[model samples]
Target chain A: MRRSLFPRLGLLLGLLFLWLPVLLLAGYAFSDARIPFQWGGFSWRWFVALAGNERLLAAAWLSLRVAASAATLAVVLGGCIGWVLARQGPFRGRPLFGALAGAPLVLPDVVTGLSLLLFFVLLEGATGWPAERGATTILLAHATIGGAYAAVLVQARLATLERELEEAARDLGAGPATTFATITLPLLAPSLVAGWLLAFTLSLDDVVVASFVSGPAGTTLPMVVFSMLRLGLTPEINALAVVILLLALTSAGGALLLLRGVLGRR
Target chain B: MSRPLLSLRGLSRRFGETVALDRLDLDVPPGEFLALLGGSGSGKSTLLRVIAGFEAPDAGQVLFEGRDLAGVPPHARPLNMMFQSYALFPHLTVAGNVAYGLRREGVARAERHRRVAEALAMVGLEEFGRRLPHRLSGGQRQRVALARVLVKRPRLLLLDEPLGALDAGLRERTGFELRALQRETGAAFIMVTHDQSEALALADRVAVLEQGRLVQLGPPRAVYERPATRFVASFLGGANVLEGRPDGAGGLDCPLLGGTLRPAETLPEGCTACALRPERIALRSGASGPNTASGTIEEVAFRGDDSLLLVRMPGGAVLRVGHAEEDGAPPPRGSTVQLSWEAAAVVPLLG
Candidate 1:
């Protein structure tokens, strides 16, 4: 009992350290006070106010749209990149390709955002495409970073997968496309879903990159929350935070359940 | 005779500076179970891959039924492979895996199910159709892989060390099952294995590879009793090799044996070595045979049905002699005995 006491205490302290502020915020969401750190009374007025804030609702919807689009785009492009890196044998540009794929992972988000902003500006100046920055720019930036995460996750999983499975498929009369669709894709489903969820969360919570690329019409939820925090904290923002937290928690839990089901069956 | 079902003409492949396969020619007849036997790095697996269309040769052609297999992808070839790992799809049920090839061939859904069920029944996995691969034992997985390949009804099947993964008892049982399956299906089998016993037991003919070249190819009995070279003699089983110079009289002046040894056939001008199987040497009491060597027994090993006696001669060479246990109690260690072998048991080896 004495030996287990220290570890149990350490775990409790770690959970409290991580969750204390979020719990405090959740408590404020239920309070009727406009100011933080002081409760007026138990009431649901802030939640009603959150529902009436049209701009906040719009920002939340926009964030959802961007996260879904970015996650999907990341999975497609990153799945391809992961396949090439993991399955293909040593080739002429393999080193360079691997380095490029992994570059965004090590590079800071601020640097990535700045570089993407500059690239969009130069691209617009030269091609006259993407006439204005809004949802498109934010999506492009989020996908760029999100794709790197997906690639790294997928490549690691693919590396551990047996190569004989693909060869066996081919020997069993499956063409390359058929093998990819049936064997490779089905086997990689768990990892792909995990990658998609990670990309979704990253896009939803993004502030630095989204700020650099987003225009007037593309104020995502994080941007709105950031601007509201600058103006001073409010119970309405606390309510919005609780809602976002719930969304993230539900998605994470759902992904865990999905992956557990897949892995457990195998 | 009918033309061979598959033929490799001057096939060669190189990986960097190492030659994985030299310019080699081989033929596989219809319904013939051929085993490629060699040690590691002998190019057995490479040759199997080439025939399966997994690896393209650097030169020459792989011909199937007189048509060149060049430019044909592995999937398009009328051949299938049983991987060493059994490579069953973990996500699929046993029935799903068996149906994969039939589905790819555009067989109707009803026919695919029928054929899959039949194949699984053939491998005795009729009740395991719904179970996933991970749920099966090693032997069961192997059977599933075989069912998957057999369902395709390919013209040829390439097995890379098919029984290498199983335990000894399972390997023996599976070996018989594999032979029985091949006979029932009448599909030509080309197996690659480093285990000589497996090759001898399963193959109608064995091809022994050395340094990426075919050193010997013939019936297993001929290859074992009459090895073509020193390497073949040692690789197949234990053979006492006596090195010497040909003595002008159809015999070799072998210092190792401390006398001139006569061979069954006349030695060529510069024959330098002869191999004699340990079992061919007989142990007799007292010195009294046409070709006899007096020696003291050095070691006695009891092998249940037979006893192996190592005899040390005057020249300090230890000759291994195998005799049945019924040959009376083996002369104890350090006891003097005379070893005799017939001239016909002596095989002359070149180089």
Candidate 2:
């Protein structure tokens, strides 16, 4: 019998080739030595030092705040748009609307970040509503990117929803709004959760957009990592990176598992 | 006059260039189980949708209890549609689906639960209320859809091919059940279907539609016995059409039928197409009678209940004769036989 195990081996090699550096960084975070590459006895000295690292924690906290705001805004606004696109027929300029919603997905993150920064500067010069760029500005920039992802996820879930089920609810005497709240929303919950988590994760990991828009108040986790890299690579920074990496992985894995469970059920 | 529960006076809908419903007028008495029967694109479904308010007609008014149904959305129509797909909400349990209507009507929570239980019991799904739609069988899903519709207690009910998704055996059983439930509820039930047997079995009266126009409307017996046009006669059942005129030669001789087999019914005004149902004819050989015609059996099919004999007449015309299987096997293929039907059995449909 031909097992064809070569593909699996190749996939493993490819994954190792990509994440080996990340694993080495995590490994070195525990090493007590001048050169991280040299074998040194494992210790929690860096992890302990990371606890006293106020600047890194502040950056991480800012990332969390921006991610939370961005995710909440993205999910709410994207959900509405996704719902409309799913239920309503394609009206005039629907293609253009769809393109605008999905444009950030294909565009480079740097381009998206720079363009959003430019747009914000223009708006401030004209309207002067957000007079200064800061956390709010960073969140707005991240949300623009995060919103595209949320909209795409919600749209996929909505498209897979059976049309007859909603019609059934309507026939049962539900008004349009009631049907949406009672039937549509409950069924769309899992997707909403997944989309929110994904948007939050993306916003938390974002560096380019945060760098472009951040003024005084905001210094996201990635920005902190990049800034610290400009200085020397401290074991404290290594510990922080490992922690953030673990958090991101956990959130993503949880969302994926939840989505699979939902899709697997009848 | 018990006011018609639903009335459509000259209802018409046009989708750009295509006429879906063309000036169709119908009045459904309260609790009458009427079947709108037609082939695909025959406007039967369009008529049902119009009545349900899923579609608004370009012209004509929908009157439910004499109130105009204009600007009324499907959700507020006081009518429910049993979709061909059954359309049970997959996320909700059977109880939830049933209670959906009650909840929307602002019924008390306890009252909604009680009614949902009652509806489920009505469909014999009381114990299965906690199950989701996809978890149930097709027939069970259909029952859940029925329960959901009945829970709202609409004055008029619309069904679009309600049993279209069921297997043959299940469909037969469900059809009888649905008719019984309709009678028990005493609501005006309108159904659209392309299956002629279903229409005959379920409808108190059947309306045959063709090309966006109703060709015939009457009780099952009346429509079957006395078709108003050729299309109705052909669609309702398999029939042998013989074109002839009553020349009254010697003793009324007809040219097309080869011999003067006594005129059945007053032959229509001109050359008439005589419709004789397959089951009405008797097959024989050698001897001739008042309604006898000689033919050779072209094919013999053994259908479980009956045997069908396809006979080729002298002039290349073919006629099918259905005889009980217990009555003995059909005349073997290639055998010559004389086909005969009673004069009254021959239905004169069109000229």
Candidate 3:
């Protein structure tokens, strides 16, 4: 009993450490206090104030657009890479190709941001395409980083999938493209959705990468929130944080349910 | 035989260091049921895959209806395979799975539904049309897989260990159903299997392979009663092999049995081995005959209907002799016994 008690307590402590800050912030979001830490009774004033903040609303809209674009791009690019790596047998430089495909997942975000920024500058100097870095540059950067994560998820899912299913499809008179459409894609749908949601969340709040890539026109909601932190905490920001947290939770819960359904059926 | 529906000439495939198939030549007549029988690593599955166009042969030609299938993909081939796992689509309904091939063929919606229902009814799965694959039992899932392939109505069907995943009782029932289905469809089937009894009972002809080469191929009775090679003899029914040479006195000098024996048939030139089925030999005590050997009984195993006796000769070679329990009580272990058989029972092995 004593031995088990220690582990139980450790788990409780770990959960507390992880959830305490978010719980405190959520509680403060309902307060009408001028100071964030001081509770001044529950009110809906800060939520209303947040609705009226045009600059913050504009940044939030920009962030949503960028996240959706980046996540969609990540799913397409990463899914192809994962399929090739999983299905195609041994080929020249496979090891090197696999390592490079997975490189962005482990690379430091600061390094990824700095390198992407440098590449954009060089490209603009060379071809003058993407003449100025803004939403397009930020979306591309996030997609590059998000794609590595999506590829890993897709590869893991493909590994659990039986190769015989594809072979059977082909044997039943479905060509390569048809087999992918009718068998492989339907089987991989859940993983792809999960990958898209994860990439969206990663792009939504990525301050470091976005800071390096974004220009004045590309100021995302996270950048605005980071700047607001220097002026001390306020209830309006707390309300914004709560709204963002709720959206993240909903998508995360969706991903978990989709994955569980896939696993349970198998 | 009528013109072969499919002909494989000098098919060879090597996986780096292992030769999966070597110089295999075979022909499948229309509507013939052929079983490729071998142990693991004997290339039975590889041969099926090559014929299905899933694997490319290192050398040789696959002619389907006299057309060279050199670069044809599996989907373009006029054949289908029932995988060992069944490989049922977990997400699709039974009816949907059966209609998948029809959909690929661009069959009209009404015709596709009619055919799908017909296929399901043939497999006795008409009531399971709307159910998903995971909802069905193992036997039911196997039937659905069968319906999926049969709906295509190809001239040839490849089955890779179709009954491998079933329990023993289910295996027998399913095997009967599968053979009946083949007869009903009248499609030639090339099945790969490792089970000797399954191959012999279901296939009209059995192709026995060893070390990536076809050792023997013939009707089931012929292959079982007259195995051409030592491998086939030893592999099929566990026949005891005796190696010897002609003694120049109208008898075979077998060092293993420590005796000179006269066989019913004249020994062909270069014949050096013969196989004697254990059931063909009879046990006696204090007896002498033209084809007889004396040995001490080593052990007796009591099977349900029959008992097997192991006789150890003075030359140290052990021979197995099977006798019906109803014949009489088995000879006690460690007793001296005379083992004898008819001259015709000794089948000469070519290799």
Q: Candidate 3 at B156: error in angstroms?
A: 1.4
**List of clashing residue pairs for candidate 2:** none
lDDT of candidate 3 over A1-266, digit per residue (tens): 44668889899999999999999998998987998878999899999999999989899999999999999999999998888788788899999999999999889989999999999999999999788899999999999888888888898899999999999999998999999999999899888997898889899999999999878778998999899889776788889889988988897788788777764543
> True contacts preserved, each candidate?
0.75, 0.71, 0.73
Per-residue lDDT over B1-351 for candidate 2, one digit per residue giving the tens place of the 0 to 100 score: 788888889888988888888888888899999999999989888888777777789999999889999998878888889988887776677887788778778899888888889999999998998777878998998899899888877768899999999999999999999999998999888999999999999999999998788788899989988777778877888766665665653123445556554545566565455667889888765657567788788888888999888888886678778988777877789988887767877666552
Q: Count the backbone clashes (under 3 Å) in each candidate.
A: 0, 0, 0
**Candidate 2 docking quality: incorrect, acceptable, medium or high:** medium
Interface RMSD list for the candidates: 1.8, 2.8, 2.9
Candidate 1, residues B201-314, lDDT tens digits: the string is 999999999878988999999999988888888788778888888888888877777766788779877779888898998876575533678888889999899999898888
Q: In candidate 1, how many Å is residue A146 off? A: 1.4
User: Would candidate 1 be rated incorrect, acceptable, medium or high by CAPRI criteria?
Assistant: medium
Displacement of residue B195 (Cα, Å) in model 1 is: 0.7
